[model samples]
Target: MASLKSLTKTLGGKDIWMLTLGKGDAESKPAIAVVGGVEGSHLLSVEMALRFAEGIISDHSDVLDNTTFYVFPNMSPDAYEQYFAALKWERSGNARPTDDDRDGRLNEDPFDDLDGNGMITWMRVEDPTGDWITHPADSRIMIKADRSKGEKGMYKVFTEGRDNDLDGTFNEDGEGGIHFRKNLTYEYPYFVAGSGEHSVSELENRALLDMLYTKWNLYGVFTFGPGNNLSSPWRYNRAGASKRVVTSILNDDAGLNKYLSDIYNETVSLKNAPDSGEQGGDFLQWAYFHFGRLSVGTPGWWVPTVKDEEGQAANKDKNREVNFLRWAEQEGLTNYWVDWKEVNHPDFPNQKVEVGGIAPFVMNNPPLAKIGDAARNHTDFIVKMAKMQANVQLVNLKTEAVGKGMTRITVDVYNGGTLPTHTEMGTRSRWLQPVKVELSLGNGQELISGRKIQTLRSLDGDASVQFTWLVKGSGTVKIQAGASHAGVDSQTVNLK
Candidate 1:
């Protein structure tokens, strides 16, 4: 923490931090940014991020020679603190007051612990018109009643609280304000709850974007959030994806996503992972679609499905709550769920009501004791990713003496790694700086052919672009080729 740079203050006055680790000329080297706490309730994300930074500096310091790292450990400090509050619940927004219901009042109907429990659980009321039903296998878990399957609705589930305003909505407004993950620029969900008044409206979002906009050397962005584009690559939809607004991952970028996903699976051992994609205005999509960088995201941890005596995995129905409860039971995790108990409610008379369900943050995050191992696995994965970044090199140089003391120099600038110097969309958008080739000639030397500096759009993997420069009167000339994100390289030539 001492080595981190405080980039800026969020709207809630929390410091947004960045720890840059690298060797000489880090600004010009290829970089990977590891961000966490994009979703405030995901406390494991913050822990994993911090562990990665600590592990890199303590164990994998050698990897920083050619690679730079920017680790943001906690992007939503205000909302993350709720995990330690006296009354705990899964919170995703920051610490700003918001009129979530738009009922001419601010936070008037916030969540209340009606049962006097330390946690905010669910409240289920027995109503024939409700759309929820208890899971047949595990009564503790609840699922939406499938009307098409002839399943009759038996209950209405709501966050545990009373509608203080009598608006008929339960706990719609809460203490925490705008959600950090829901306030990005790409595919901004306008006018939606938690999407904010406009995209990038929050101080935290603006601060992070400002830093990214200035750091042109960043080639990849790795976020620890709800999205899992790293485990399962996003599928491309030609028509809908290629629209002017661009809803899907670009075809070329989707290929890269698959390539990286294979690397992730090989490096990490966790399996039976859930498939989750980008919601509108998420950091993962914003990194690629708007920031023009190769972006990857993961939750860092999830419970693997438990197996039965016959060696088959339990909960084949794919109900998250049911599967989570079964897994918790198999693991002897008794504290995750609270038994439902009848409770009196002010809003309803002569109706059956109860407050109980899975405790907050347990389903999304593993127990604190298990996070150390998970963090170690993620740290290794991130280091592996850094090794695959674009490594540009200058090769195949030839010098020829032309007529009347003119020397013609030729060389090929190549990308030697599997990844391209820039994403296809990045090249198309022209946001990332193109690879720059420059020649430093000695005193009184004049260039006769090629420009002093040449910018190439992009260099594909194992691909090269040849450049020729004709100069007059040079004893020794130094030529350099690369971009901030591509990793620069240089060669010295003696024109005799």
Candidate 2:
């Protein structure tokens, strides 16, 4: 069964819909949340998520027997809609009014579409004081000056904008307000631009957190956004992982990440992906560090290495814009590049300021035609994760007549799947309920030994512990084990 719900509305009054697919309600089975729009600018994520949901509901509902799915396709609809607005710009924040510069002014010094191209692109101002110069590898792209390489600075780069508030800043603050991507509680970036007054302060962030906290059955999270550890898993840094306030992936979690990362690489055709650098207040880290769940993220697409006239991969410089332009040209994608047109700017009255660059949202997002390949492959990969969900089993049950009326009942409470009952971080946080094992006695049965109820902090995959209970005058005893997120199992035994 599937449930479509509007959990909450964004500050801009956009409905944030989450699709719950499972045997029953979303909470009835172990779930893996698929989140999109972590960065409102990455429009491809929303589509990727949508496709995943479609794949499950249309074809792969069999996985629903064990793994439920909670798909939030577009969490930042306010900023996502900007992609289709009259003036397009890469926006990550929502519509709520925010003083991004902390200057007591709201939406001041917004970007200007200088060339009237209806897109906020880059502006290059030629000046000797500038620390940026045209890339030597590709003249059309810019790279910072390298003094040791005898490269002299010749151009200053800024968004196409003017200092509307006379604050000597160009587009320092804009209509796009607080960001759901930058408003998470873990490693919260306090007083940072685009990160609201406090963590989870934005409506979108608060609503998602509220939903996440209530879902005790969630075992993992898969997000389509910029903070990717799916392509290349982050290595365990002992220093960061050992801190009083843990920052890096814990040892056990890092191993599991490597395990999952290998599966991701195998499932997705995209390769040679750059590591998604760390960003404070991102949902990816929060899902692991604070929320205590297995979380993996991917941008879903990136500029592929372009081929030269000889049909060989060219542009080895690794500069994203340079590589992007190379790929766009090879793919014959038009309007993606705003050919550096000379534009007169009031701020740079006496200087040469050219308005041009890659069009907004093309570098991170692929052409709509190419979205299907990635979406399909990613959906297949998410379904493969069902194999890792914890499964409870009662192994090697043994009963002995210890006395005339007393019977010894023993069972091995075990986890049969590859992943532990709880994540390494979950154990550290201790927020999730432990794997519970209980003995339900029959009529007139009395317990003489062992615990009627016991909790195990965690049970690693293929690991087991013996649980024994001595009962007097038992007709039948039921042994039940597992957590809500972990698969549950029970066995009934007949006592003589």
Candidate 3:
């Protein structure tokens, strides 16, 4: 049976619900934590996580018996509410108030609907010294001038808001606080906007991490957010991985990530998936580097390439905004773009300023119903992943009697699953369980050889390590192997 628990209330008093969707006790089984709403700007990720939870509960209950799922439906509920709020922009933080510009002011220069459309869009100003120009193919989109191509810029772009605080920066300090994506312990960005005063300083950030720490069997974490390492796997770089700060994935876990990425691409098969490379402190990177788990993440959805009249997909290397406009027109998607119109502004009286561009949240988040295949495919992929978790078994138990009352007992600790017991980072972090092979002898029994408890770091998939013990004057003895996440298996033997 599935159960929902609130981790804590967001600053807006929204309940951040964590759902344990599976059979029996979730903590007792190996689990994958499906996290959504890492960034409130990505509303589609929230829909994906919710639909997966619903799909798993209704259709894939049988898979839950072996695998538990901890579903975090939303992490930044405070900012997420802005989607339905009166004035909406792409907000990424929680409700806690902070000087986003760190200028000793709180949201004093927030976004203003210059067009009064009740939505936030871009503001472009025509100026000779500007570094932006209209896209060659689509005048509705803006692109940076490439001096190498002899393109000259004729406009400057900014968010749709004037300098309310007269800081000469438009909408630098927005409503809300730390971005959960940036307020993580791993590679925490210092003094950066939306990175928070310090890492893990926000309530939701602290609460989510604390809850994750308690889940002993959570070996895999799936984060749905801005960064992507799923559709296209990253390569392992020894030099970067060996850095004192560990800037890249370890060699061992890197291969695993590549394998999983292949499976993800095969399962989802979403075309034109955007690979937003990792920045510091995001959940996708933190889960692997800090949490020491098999972590993978993606945006789950992206704008597909528009096809020509002959049904051939256009080259994706084109300007993203122009590409999006073409796809939107082809798909009959409307109201997502704001046409440029001259607006009277206080910031600049002489320059011609216009407010209009692609609407916020429309680029990252598609129509909710468009992701049905994504949810179903992800569900199937995760279910397959659940069945692949490391399983420990005490196999090949044998006992031989010597000429005297002494007897020898032997057993192999084997991992019979696709994934190894511990990830390369998991072993290095020393956070996960270290395997144990223990021998418990009867009152009359005495150990003559081998460690009473043998401990080591890791076990590869389809691999086994043997442990032998010589007992003196033994009656009965019990041999147990393994620890929490990898699982423990025991064997009982009678000695003569």
Candidate 4:
């Protein structure tokens, strides 16, 4: 931002403008703005953003000038500190206690690390009437109640421990303050544990919102979270049977789905997917719906698993299972399970603790050994998109020699960034500024062509408008076009 300010000062304050990008813009650029670690445990998100930025700053030059890359290495800085401090936080909120269960108690009870092993793992209680039962096919997994199948559920599954509230609710609300991502107007899992009212309730979220609103040139976003990559099997296959977790259809012009399909398909296999619910206020939806630009959410890492004891190739129908176990072993991700230690919990009197799932710094996060490789691949992707941002285009220009000695000069300004000049009508009503265009004399005292043409106090992609001016005598003029995304452009033509 200081660099932008300095550039603004050098060019006459009029030419160098600073417009907010966020919701109200013509078009956002292909420029990728990454926000990492929305969840406390996911420190890898920060690593991903830093890696991408480091690559851009170090290797790519032309892209730096052409595209504006903004990096918030760790948007959830507070969450990170909390996770590190507690050493056992799997929370996405910022430690704000609310009534997650709606039983009139405000975060009264939550999950506990009963065994004190420095990690929170699932706890199974032997309840005869429990709604969940161990899957017949896989003893390690849990399944929901099924009356039609005549199979009864005997075990209850909770978030690794007993309820702290003492009201009988297990893992309702634990630690942390507030989750900025949940607070945002986008997809908020409201009334659920730590979600505050609107978006940006926490200081960290507010800070990010401030930057996004003020930096209007930001066109595209590549958020690292629960979302999948634009590459591979996950990219190609629709959420299919999983209606709750669906992805936006690809634009016909963007044939990048093939490459994405390969990656997702190649990396992970399906073991189980939790039920999906309505995402009330999602970040990417806000970016796309409000800005009319492409916004993507991607899980930073994935693990493929396999179920074949014979070590045979996976069948067509159950490709996911094969991928999941395969990845867990191949990556050397820790099993964390230590001989099924026996632990007596207030909730479960006779049950054993099983520390399963991809271990810390393993599956969900890249192994320490390959963090560099993960960083390199994503950085390369960011640099590639940055170069693709549209700098400037001559959409339309008209010149007419008036009846006598006057000439009329008309021109249109366009924003080719992936975003719009101004976002939705709501954003404009909020008085967001659109991008502005200007026209002036090339040199000397000659006001022949036109004056400065202004737009939304902000400007986005594919957003453009025209300006015209009537001048006298046969002279020359300069038409300069500028935007927060494309930077600057100037063209000179004779007025004869």
Query: Which candidate gets the maximum TM-score versus the true structure?
Result: 2
Pairs that clash in candidate 1: none
Alpha-carbon lDDT, every model: 0.86, 0.87, 0.85, 0.53
Cα misplacement distance, residue 203 of candidate 3 (Å): 0.7
List, residue by residue over 25-128, the lDDT tens digit for candidate 4: 22343245676665555678777876666666566645644555655555455555544655454555554556666677666565566667766666666677
Candidate 1 scores a C-alpha RMSD against the true structure in Å of 2.0
| Models, CA RMSD each | 2.0, 1.6, 1.9, 8.3
Clashes of each: 0, 0, 0, 76
TM-score of each: 0.96, 0.97, 0.96, 0.72
Off-target runs (Cα >4 Å) in candidate 1 are 308-316
Model 3 residue 490 lDDT? 84
Better of 2 and 4 by lDDT: 2
Give the C-alpha miss distance for residue 180 in model 1, angstroms: 0.5
Model 3 per-residue lDDT tens digits across residues 341-417:
89999888899999998888898888766888878998888888888888888999888988578888888899988
Q: How many steric overlaps does candidate 2 have? A: 0
lDDT of 3: 0.85
Tens digit per residue, CA lDDT, model 1, 102-148: 87788888889988879999999999999989877667778889989
Give, for candidate 2, the lowest lDDT window spanning 10 residues: 306-315
Clashing pairs in 2: none
